[model samples]
Target: MSVRIATDGSATTVTASPRTLTVCVVITTEERAEPSWVPQLEDCSPALRRALERVGLQAGELWLHLLGIGLERGAPTAAELVDAVAELAPAELRRHLVGVHVPAWRALVGADTLEAAARGDRNADAVLLADECYYGGRARDSLSLLLPLSVAQTKKRVADVLRRFHNEVFAAREDELVAQLERDVDAKRARSLSPDALITAATRGYVYEPEPELGRVVLVPHLAARPWILLCQHRTTRLICYAAEPESAPHAQEVRARALKLGRALGDEKRVLVLARLAAGEAGLAELAESAGLAKSTVHHHLVLLRDAGLVGMRGNDQGYRYFLRAEGATESSGVLGDLLAPR
Candidate 1:
């Protein structure tokens, strides 16, 4: 499932000078990958997975937001980042984890109310529920899970899960992962792209038009977030966790695997109809579902497959998610398959 975090910014043009922009990368597990993208992350630890599910934390990109916050605070290394979270006061840790879902949560909810909610004040909880930030289905669940617990209790559970995940899932390949991300960051830096272009490239085609209140945009490359970008806004700063670019050439097996993925995406009649509708222009989930003559849930399933195959991309707006075809992926499938089957 995709983890879509809402933002207050509308679709508008925003420009930033080099002094206001920062680019970096953070460490996370392949478990962060969307279901559509990887289907299965074989190395993901079963125990760690169980821990996440137990806490009702299905969206792995939530950790990416935590990592991005740490990166912004000068916790460059994974170990340092884990420490950063560990060091935060229990109340502050609760805010960071919950606020990652809701934009401008502090200003909107106020510190006192948040504290009250942590203390099991129903009125304070209602205030948070009424706020627009907590409106998303997942955001609602995130808040619900933590609201019942004391802030300190939430902190203990969150810290335990993060530390265990880092040690069991990310620590072994830390060097290799960091080196790959560094190469991508360096390559992007060398290009000297304009702010808009850099954002689009970093997000793999998401053209972010920062809001007027925003000043700094930090792009954090994440390997687990492939084919999907995670966005978090902290007042004036926007943290974009983008899919990391692979440093190595695709192996023969890799090429074939991609071809098979594309084939699966194109295999169904309803999905083909959905693609045809998207080919004409961008459409929201409802519109595509209508065009495909299927339930929104069924249409969403097809969209996920299309997304995983790299044939579709989406942009969020005030209205909701609007999806479009990735022309490059659609047009290159034949060549990908040909390369896979060509005589060696």
Candidate 2:
């Protein structure tokens, strides 16, 4: 409920100065419903699906790893759509699987926009180029949020989706889409949004909330975890947010639990090695200890913690106890870790 992110000299008071815009969160009336005035988000859904499908399974795991149950429960298609991309791919093609990631390559709203806006200089271009996956904005955290996919691959997929949309969907749906967008714009103009409302709505799972200084803030509702903050890192700064719904209050405990588990499991180098080993297959405690070059007791202790965190599950056999990672748990834990690391 409290403001977790703050910028120096940010407007503490919700005074009407300038900088506010609202576009439809967007949704198609339905696949076959009569065209209505609703600003359709049909494109956003497919765009995400296509992007993930283009990227493949690595994309699926990555999205889940970063977003946890949020992506699994909310934007299910995103990860599920690409579940087989890597498996069905040729070795060379599969090798091209870079990776999916949290945050994103760059903030839709770059640091440039944040600084400029703070100076009372809003950039129009920054608000124009909002990315479809809008829940990412911390420009400084780019390196840590790295994906496995190459630049070329991402670009190619984006281009291909756009091309397909241009030829098929957009051609048939442009009028509807644009009409709804324009209508939403007009409707938003009739209402005013306070700064507090803007910040609260803009933020998602992470602690860091971005308070960009802009005269014209455009909120594009999305179904992703974070609101994509496209800053003006390049051209003109566009303060646009492809916002996903905030996590329900009930789910907060789960997020915190996952984060804590990942934290405890990741704190030691030996445990990390244990996790890496388990990634390949199950290993007995002796093997894990030898490989990690830690004492048996030490390794056992690590395993205990990992097991409790649900990072690893162990079984007893004729030889002794063997441990293997709970892949889903690991992913969910890691995803929470990403959320924890997001820029404040």
Candidate 3:
């Protein structure tokens, strides 16, 4: 049997078999910040090789399809990259092709453009979109609208407090400080509003909006893998969590049991789903419920169990709650799961 590995924020699907595994890295480069050129081509080539090696896939045994989109310098367009991938991909494997988009670039151009490029590939297996580096030197920031004046000032005040707190806890890295600031800002924002108002605002700004479609696009990066970890923004707050998949019988039972326990305790489907999804990072609820054909509500019930278990959490947004995967102390299972089953 062949195993399909899809990643978040990507347009290419990778299939691993006894004989071979193919990887298609779709890169769209622009000249806005730095001039017209491929920034990561040289870096990414070796990184891809190393990533594949770590995953037990060798360079020679794999087919590397590089789709480069040159933006603004008479370079390759998004369409060109798609066409190149289509042309290079083996017909049979193309049917199982996976798509990945680097989040840093995706945020600059917009996900719709990337999604449109992949639309022609009908049989794509999974799409991987990335927002930040998992290993954590500098965490990438997803796009967010500037807050209204009132909210912005309030956030600033909270951020100042958090900056100091994080400095004491972590260090002088601005990146880490910013993360702490975001968390504090979110906490304060949640406490300032009612749950209903928070939900409505968050849904409008991040979830349902058409222009950016931040919620959906943010989710794209996590779709390519087994356990999906979604780090979602809700207004001033941010959340991280595992979006578990329960496609198989054993997994489904485990998910249901865990979900039931948490659901009964929490009594909130949205909260539960957010937490459970965080726990199952890279394989969130939508994928898990794919086989069960359950309504979002039914699937959400399972999510609540983990929320109550304190294994998952939700942060308040100006509109709705943003879910997060709580990363507690390290465990053996955390190490064993590697990328797919690791806790957020």
Candidate 4:
């Protein structure tokens, strides 16, 4: 759940700069997301309540074993859930299915033997359940609890729940979700290419991690909570899966300042003429003054502002200042129009 990028941009071009944001990746998944969805949700009251009413069959092994412990409100019935998983392969289903007490059961899995988890009073602290096994004389209430259904039942139930959640919530919104992420990637790229590059993204679910080789940041949309984005490492990819929310402006303040400055700078008749003259070729103070029909001092004053704003630069001669747009500033400026002109 952490990523690192010690260097900035490509080594071939800009070389090293400060590493503000290292590696980021965005991925989408209905299946992977289910593990954390109903259980850990901040506002579980609604879903829990709904589960009690609408989720009639809570008997599936995936839901029962994983969401086990205390069933307060939204637990589906055991029979309905077990029936859902009845078609899966027994061996494969057995692999993931477990008793209601998963923590104790998982501990049993990691240990060399069930006896490995033995405590003072109990000879065995946990037990692994496999078809008609734990529920019968071999295990059950002795070392472990009964699995709600067989492996086949758990598998089918899991698939049904996953398919249902996807179609109901995520499928219709997939394209729009991906499109928003693409805009974010484009915006980050624009900043990454700048001279003093920095990435400024806000998320509640994730934080910056340190790594030597930083990969690209991507967006993963989920039926997750707002602003909460989960960051995890996937081989070379740094995946950021977040609870879905509507798209907000990217780096909104930077876009506004850039737009305002550039707008005012171009709003004058005299300044426009000076820009036109400069575009043709480099010009000194006197040359630009003559072309604009303005006094040398007035033109000089404008040139000073342009330079300060990063729209003008000093020539190779050093003595002469030439008015030219900075690539860095333009890169940022381009995104402003894209943001403002975007749908309200």
Please name the candidate that would achieve the greatest TM-score relative to the true structure: 1
Per-candidate TM-scores read 0.73, 0.28, 0.21, 0.31
Evaluation by TM-score, superior candidate among 2 and 4: 4
Residue 33 accuracy (lDDT) in model 4: 14
Give per-candidate clash totals: 0, 30, 64, 21
Cα deviation at 73, candidate 2, in Å, is: 34
Compared with the true structure, the alpha-carbon lDDT of candidate 3 equals 0.30
Ordered from best to worst lDDT, the candidate numbers read 1, 2, 4, 3
lDDT of 3 at 121: 23
lDDT of 4 by residue, 37-112 (tens): 2232223345433432232332322232222111211222333333333443554334433332222333334434
TM-score of decoy 1: 0.73
For residues 126-183, write the lDDT of model 1, one tens digit per residue: 7876675443334554566656677787787777776776777666777776677677
**Predicted candidate 3 versus true structure: per-residue lDDT over 134-180, tens digit per residue:** 10111111111111123333233223322322233222333432333
Rank order by TM-score, top first?
Answer: 1, 4, 2, 3
Per-residue error for 257 in candidate 1, Å, reads 3.9
Candidate 1, superposed: residue stretches over 4 Å from native: 1-54, 57-61, 100-120, 126-135, 250-254, 293-301, 308-310, 316-320, 327-330, 337-344
> RMSD of each candidate?
6.9, 18.8, 22.0, 22.1
Candidate 1, clashing residue pairs? none
